[model samples]
Target chain A: MANLVNYYIQFIKRDLQLAVRQKHEFVLPLLFFVLILILFPVTVGPESGLLARLAPAVGWINLILSLLIALPRMFSEDYENGWLEQVFLAAVSPSFFILTRILSFWLLYCLPLVICSVLLVPFMSLPFDIWWVLAQTLFLGSLLVAALGSVASALLVASRKGSGVLALLLLPMLIPALIFGSAVIEAAQQSLPYLSPMLLLAALAVFCLTIAPVAAAQAIKINLG
Target chain B: MFKWLHPYAKPERAYALANRLYLWLWPLALIGLFTGSLWGLMFAPSDYQQSDSFRIMYIHVPAAIWSMGIYMSMGIAGICALVWQMRSFELSVLAMAPIGAVFTAIALFTGSFWGKPMWGTWWVWDARLTSELILLFLYLGVFALFYSFDDKRAGAKAACILAIIGMINVPIIHYSVEWWNSLHQGASITKFDKPSIAKEMLWPLLINIFSCLLLFIALTCYRFATELLASESHRKWVTKIIQ
Candidate 1:
């Protein structure tokens, strides 16, 4: 068990190291998130009321787009460099490997989006309470997205046109998460009860965390075989 | 039984079975479809409120039920493929995609046709309609994923994973009306205590639903046979059966 913990920590460190090396790829999703958020204000006019009304939706859309932009490279780098096979043949179980990979992805891809969500909160003229709700929902929802992404990445690792097909398969499944997350923030803005949406978002996160690693592990075995 | 089932996992044997099955199914499907359609369209009583517009239930209800049923079937086929590593199961999943898509589309069209006369608009963001649209997208996504890969095995694996994950959406779609306050009426035919529809209406609805189910079975068998043949055209079974 201690060894498994070490493996996870090491995996995260290695991913962080790689992110440092490929700084451009790491920054691209952040830039895309900002650009997308900026589009709403420009397109919908600079009216504060309209922007506030659209804020939760804008944040949710950016969260999805950022995840998509970051998803293709989640496993491609290791798969291309033959590191994934090494991990498969290692002493670690496939589940452990998948869990570590998903955690690292959430840390790298989603954590930044959460920060960006905070930064963009003022642009949308969002209330403090709604901003808090958006932040919480984004954190949970992005974790779920990252878990689902690991499964998609593992499944598509060996396929041609894997990335595009991955997005097509994954984006539709992301709808419920998007709806729940955005709805929570929307509920907050209206000063209505936000508990139901938050609980739903958390349930989705738990569901993804429970099932995705196992599915992803199976996918990794299939790809390696 | 397992041994007997094992042999049919081979594409050729599956193809042969599907071919034989289709021969029996097509005739019965035609009989059921023709008989059901004639009865439902003409003999079924008109609604007290909506009149003949409720006749659309013959098509709408069956297609809606099938839209969910086919997804469940596809998900089961996917699980079977993953567990047994059967190529035939993968082919079934593939064949089910377009059939499921067609059923979902028919459900949506018939739903709108029913809705326009009843709801005074062709479309609304009501739970049933919204979820049905999502179901169509799910089918399209599965088909898109199936064709996206160059290798058949890899494609099947990816699509199987997708079908399994997307299964979560199915329950949400089915129960969306109950869970949320929506304009769409809850299940009238499927309820337990007593179905809301009268016996005169109920009989035709059941017949139509049965016919639709038979048609789906016939179509899936035919499509599975075609897929098996296409994928394994050079096999000895193909040479023996076609010639």
Candidate 2:
């Protein structure tokens, strides 16, 4: 048990150190996320109510997209360098590696989105009360996105096809999260009980957290074979 | 039972069985489709409310049901392939993708046509249509994933993982959509409650359902056989058959 824990910790520390060294991977997606927020108001016109109404959806879409943009980095580096095959075949289980990657991704990619959305919320004219709800939804939803997106990244890591197919495969599964995240925000906007959708998103996060690593491990194994 | 079923674990035996089944399935499918369409389009009494627009239900409903059915079978084939490493099951998964896509497209198109006159709009964000749209996307994803790989076996395995994942998600997607629909659209416009279906209408629909299933089986079997043959052309049995 201690050995397994040590392996997981070591994996996270290694990936985080890589993430710090290659700050561009983190900065590029962050820039894209900020650019999406800035561009939406310009494209849709600066009407505050419209922006408020559209903010939840636009934010959620951008959140998923930004996460997606960073997804290729999740496995491609290891895959390209051939370390992924070594890890898969190594004494350490691939699932732990996948889980570590998912955790670090949520920290580096998803965590930043949640923090920045705090600043963007009031700028978009959304209700303050719903900000808390949006925060809750984004936190959970980002974890789900990271977990699910890692699976897609693993599957596509070895394939020559780029992010288009990855998006095609990932986006549909992301819908429920998108729907519930925005729905809870909308619910909070109307002062209705938003707890149900929040709970549902939690369930989805838990479900993804459990299944994605195993599936990702299997996908990596298949790709390696 | 295990003894009887053991031979089919071999791809050669399975392909032969699928080939034999296709011989019966295609003709039966054609006859049933024609008969069902005739009965549905002409003999079935018009819906009291919907009248003739409801005749589209025969095609739409069957296509919709089979779209889901094909995915379910694909999921089963995926599990079999994963568990036993059966090449036949992998080929079946590949063969079923286009068939499922076509059926899903039929369902969506016929659904919109039926919707135009009934709901006064060609599209609605209701649960059934929304879920069907997602199913279409799932089918496209399967196709995209399959063709993206250089190694066909690896592609099939990856697509199988996706199929199994998708199969698990379908029910959750359906339930979530249902909840979303109920909350947003109060009392669905697309509810085809089985208990409410009249006998006259139900009979023709049932026949069409059977016909559609036969059509799926026939098409899938033929496609699987062709795929099997192509992949196995250098093998002894394929050589003998070709000779």
Candidate 3:
């Protein structure tokens, strides 16, 4: 058990180290989030009320879309260089490798976006009271993205084209997370009971956590043969 | 558990089974469709309120229900394909996607037609309607995925994986949409009292629903046979059948 844990820890460490080496991989989604959220305020006119009203939804969508932007990059390197092939050849389980990859992705791709979303809370004219709810939902919601994104990245490994099919495959699956996460924000905005949506979001993330890695491993093996 | 049914796992047996079943199913489906449509369209009493507009429900409701039903079946077929590596089940997964998509489209069109008169709008983002739209998108995603692969087998497998994901997420999508809709709009959707459907209206509706199911299965069988032919075209049985 200790050996298994240590083995997976190295995979996670390797992935995080790779992200750290490229530092821009971490900054890209965050930059996209800020730039696009800024565009919304500028384009929609300077009205605080509309910006505040649109804040939760607009925030959630940009976060999701920017994460979509970061998706193809997630696996293209390892897939093209045959790193995945070497891992599978070593008889290391693909699911463990995939789960740790997703965990590091959550750290690199989703974590920064969630943190930046909290920082930009003021720019969107969001209610200060909703930040905690917003952050909690973003944190949970993006983990679901990492899970689903792992499956999609695995899928992309099999398919020939990189055209926006990743977005098509991942976006629809993320609707529940989007709806649940946004509900948490909106409920907090109105000061209504928000606990249920928050809990549901966590449940959803947990559910995806169990299924996605296995499914992703399956996708990889299907293509491998 | 599935050991006794092992014979049919061969592509030839599965194809022959579908071919034979479709032959019987076609007649039943046609008769049910003809009689049910005639009765529902002309003989079934017009609703007390909104009169004939409610008749659209006969088609709309059945299509709506079965779109969801076909999606469930596809999910099962997908599991069969991925887990058991059943080649025939893979054909069914591919065959069923377009059918499910068409059913979802019919439901949406009929729904808007009904909505125009009943709800005073051509469309509304009601929870059910929105979820149905999402279902249509899921079908399209599976359909598109299948075509995108060079190896049809790989395509089927990938599409099946997607179908499984959709099945898991569909309920969560529906519930979350419902919760979100409730937050925006307060109980504005008109409720249909199901037990109140009259016997005259109910009978034809039931008939139509049954006919639609038979027709859907028949079409799936037909599609399965044709696709099985394509996939097995190089085999002796296929050449023999072609002869």
Candidate 4:
């Protein structure tokens, strides 16, 4: 157990080092998130009331699109560089390797989105109370996206042309997260005291956390074979 | 029993069993489809609320049920492929993709046909309809993934992983109507106690469902045979089976 924890710590530390060295990959999704939010009001016209009304959906859309853009890069670099192959051949179980990879990805890909969500709030005319709700929902919901992304990445790890199909496969499964996350913020906007949607979002997070690593591990084995 | 079944995992035996079953299945499927459609389309009583539009249920419901049903089967086949390293199971999953996609498309089409008169729109963002659309995409993704790679074994592995991941969506699709406050109605027939529909309606629906099941079996068998032939084209079995 101590060895497992040490392995995770090392994995996370290495991932952080990589993230710091190659900061563009981490920053791009955040930039995309802001750009999408900015484009929405311009596309829909500059009415604060209208923007406020559509804030929850806008936030949800930005979250999903940003995640989609970030997904292909999650494993493509590791797979291409043969780092993943080394991991597969390592002493660590594939399941543990995948879990550690997903954790690192969640930290790099999703944590930025949570920070960006705070910046996106004012542009959408989001209420101060709902900003916290959106932050919480995005944080929880991004974990689900990271988990699902891990499975998708593992599945497509071997394919030359995998990104397009990965999006088609992963996006549909994200509907539940999209719905629950958007609903929480929408409820907050309405001053409806939105706990149910947040609770559901947490449930989705728990579900994804439990199942995705095993699926991802299996996918990696198949792809490696 | 397990020993007896093990031989059929071999391509040659599977092809032989499929060949024999194909002859029998065609006739039964024809009879079932003809009688079932007649009973469902002509004889079933009109819904008190939906009138003739609900007749679409005869086709749509069965197709929808099979769409989910076949996906689960594919996932199981995938698990078998992954765990037991069964190439035949992988081939079966590849074969089922197009058939499942077809069923999902039919379900979605018939659903829209039903929805037009009932809901006054051809499409709605209802939970069931949305989930069914997602299922179709899942099927298409699997099919596309399998054919995308030049390496057949690699393609099959990729698709198998995809099948398992997509399986998570199946239960979500099934329960989306119940979980979300959407325009789609909840299940009427899946309940254990009794179905919500009248006996007259239920009987024909069951017949239609049976007919669809037979059709799916026939289609899957035909597809599996074709896949086996393609994969084993250089083998002695292909020459024997073709001749």
Candidate 5:
């Protein structure tokens, strides 16, 4: 049991180290998130009511799409570096490796977006009171994104052309998150009871957290073979 | 445990069994489908509210049910293939996807036709319809993922993972959409009242349901047989059968 914990820590450390080595990979999704925030107003025109109405959807979508941008790199880099093979052959189980990878990804890819979204909330002219709800939704919502994207990344690890198919596979599964995340903010904006949607989002995040890694690990084994 | 049934788990035995089953399934499917459609279209009473337009229910509802039913069956097959390493179940997943996709499409198309008259629009973001649309996309994802890999078995395993993921998501999608729909439309979709299903209307619907299910089974068996043959084409058994 101690050995498994050590292996888990080592995997997380290695992944965080790799993430830190290429700082831009971590920053790119954040940058993309910011860019979309700027671009939506330009494309849709600078009307505060429209932007306010669109804010929840725009924020949720950009977060999910930016997560997609970060996803393909999740497993492909390890596979290309031949690190995944070594990790699989080690005493650490694939599920643990995958779970740790998803955790690091949620930290690296999702956490920054959650923080940035809080800052971006004012720019969209959404009510300041809803900011906390928006932040909460973004935080929980993107964990589900990270978890589902992990499975997509694991499955597509060996494919040369993967990003397109990954989006197709992951986006449909991400709809619940999209619905709940945006709905929470929408509910809050309308002064309705928003707790239900928030709880649903957290539930979804937990469900994905438990199931995705094992499925992803199985996918990785299949892709490896 | 049915120990005596173990031999049927072999691909050759399964393939042979599927082939034998096809003989009865195909003719029964045809008869049921033709009679059910004819009876439902002509004999069954028109809905008092919608009249002739409601006849589309015979196709739309059955197609909707089978599309979801096929995906659920395929998901179960996927579990067997991935967890137990069953080749026949792998073949079952491969065979079921396209059929499920087609049924989903038929449901969507017929749904639009039905909606145009009932709702005075070609589309509504109703919960059932949106959920079925998402189901179509899920089926397409499995197809795309399965074919993307150069290694057939690897592709199957990858697709199986997706199938399992989708199975978990299906109910969540359905419930979420239902909630969203009710929030937006508010009690407009309570048309599925079980007590309102008169005996005259219910019998034809039941007949059509059975026919559609039989058709799905027949199509899946046929597709599974051909898929098995194609995959095992280089084997001695395949060559002997061809000879």
Candidate 6:
């Protein structure tokens, strides 16, 4: 299936190329994330203990929100430019394309943000040792967000609804990710056994990853029809 | 496959069936509801611990169970709709959503009324309560999704997919919320264990549960009929019925 692989790679390259051309597609989420990081420290006051205690929560919650900003990237371009019928049809296995498209968006949207978040961990008043655990959980949480967000975005293509409905359909599903992601951080801080939450996060991400692409492919087709 | 299901798959047959079932269902639901509430509220001896406040359990327990049950049924309807492309199931999904949302709301309110006396507050982030709140949100989302599309069929498909996804999520969410936090009591009744309630209290609660299910079915049948008629007014069968 070399042809299939090529088509998948081509679609991902196109998504990345478009983001590079716009410059801001990826930058905006990063900017929003950094702004949230700054806002928390200043607004919540500069007390180290309090900031440290609140940091994991503030960071995880804002990261989920920032990722929400990046959600439409998964399928919106193909949808808006009417390339979906062609691009999705060109690939015999549309789920492959769907997976890659979300993967690229996740790479561009979540990776840099997660790395930046880890780099700034000291500023969030977290222990330096937490970097590894923090990075692991952030990656998993963002993966889950990308998967769920892509499905929601695909559904939106059919519905033509506003962002409010998207948020309504989405936020409730994000709860477990929020709970476990923050738990991972808190566990790290306390030096308690953090493996359970991280494993849980990994399970969530993988589960969504498997299901989202297929469901989204169906949604795009149904919506486009 | 499922050859017997073919005739009932037709909107006309399903609508007529629902209409016939409604006649029986509504009266039974009403009579059962009245009897169950009277028995549970007035006849059941007051709980030694909760006393009079425990009386609210009649409403709260049934509403909570059926709120979840309704969503599960919607999920089943969704899967059938997607698999068979059954428009009747789609209509049923839409018809049941508001009622599901209402049941969830009733559960929450009755819960808090009991909680204020027992838990010393109107609300807590307990596992059951939070998940119930989330279920309400799911109902709102499911209902809203159905109307969001320019293409009604497309909207139904998308909402069906979402309901299925939500059905899958509810248990995961329930357990996760449990792991995250909980303060409510364990199940008051169970299949294996002797029900934790007094025998006298348990019978009325059981009656209330079944009556609530009947009420839900009766109401959904009524609404499903209306949905079918509204969507297919120009169809000959619908027109003939109208005349």
Q: What TM-score against the true fold does each predicted structure earn?
A: 0.93, 0.97, 0.94, 0.92, 0.95, 0.94
lDDT string, candidate 5, A121-198, tens digits? 678887767877888888898888899999999999998778899999998998888778767887887889999889
Summarize candidate 1's per-residue lDDT along A1-225 as a digit string, tens digits: 888788888888999999999999999999999888888899999999888888877887788878888887787778889998898888888787888888888888899888888756578787766777888898998998998888877777777677787787777677677767766775676688889878988997888888898998887777777
DockQ (Cα-based) for each candidate: 0.50, 0.77, 0.65, 0.59, 0.77, 0.74
Off by over 4 Å in 5: A1-5
Would you list the C-alpha lDDT of every candidate in the order shown? 0.81, 0.88, 0.85, 0.81, 0.86, 0.84
lDDT of 6 by residue, B60-166 (tens): 99999999999999999999889988889899999999999999999999999888988788887777788999999999998787778888888888999999999
Error of 4 at B23 (Å): 2.0
Model 2 DockQ, alpha carbons vs. true complex: 0.77
- In angstroms, the error of model 3 at B155 is 1.6
Q: For model 3, how does the per-residue alpha-carbon lDDT over A1-225 read when each residue is reduced to its tens digit?
A: 787789788988898888789987668888889899889989999788888888878778888999988887777788778888888787667888888888888888898888888755688778777776788898999999989998887876767775478877888888888888877887787789989989989998998998999999888777677
Candidate 4 on A1-225: residue-level lDDT in tens?
A: 999999999988998999999988778988888888889989999888888778767777778779888787777788889888899899988888788888888888788787777765578777767778788888898888899888887777778777788788788888878777766776776688778878978998888888888888877777767
Native-contact fraction for each model?
0.41, 0.61, 0.61, 0.52, 0.65, 0.67
Backbone collisions counted per model = 0, 0, 0, 0, 0, 0
Error of 3 at B40 (Å): 0.9
Interface RMSD of each: 2.6, 0.8, 1.3, 1.8, 0.8, 1.2
lDDT of 2 by residue, B1-243 (tens): 989999987768888999999999999998998988999999999887888988999899999999999999999999998998888888999999999999999999999998899889999898888999999999999889988888888999999999999998889888887787787757666557534888888888898999999999999999999999999888999988888
Question: TM-score (chain A) of candidate 2?
Answer: 0.96
Clashing pairs in 2: none
Give the TM-score of chain B in candidate 1: 0.90
Between candidates 5 and 6, the one scoring higher on lDDT is 5
> By TM-score, how accurate is candidate 6?
0.94
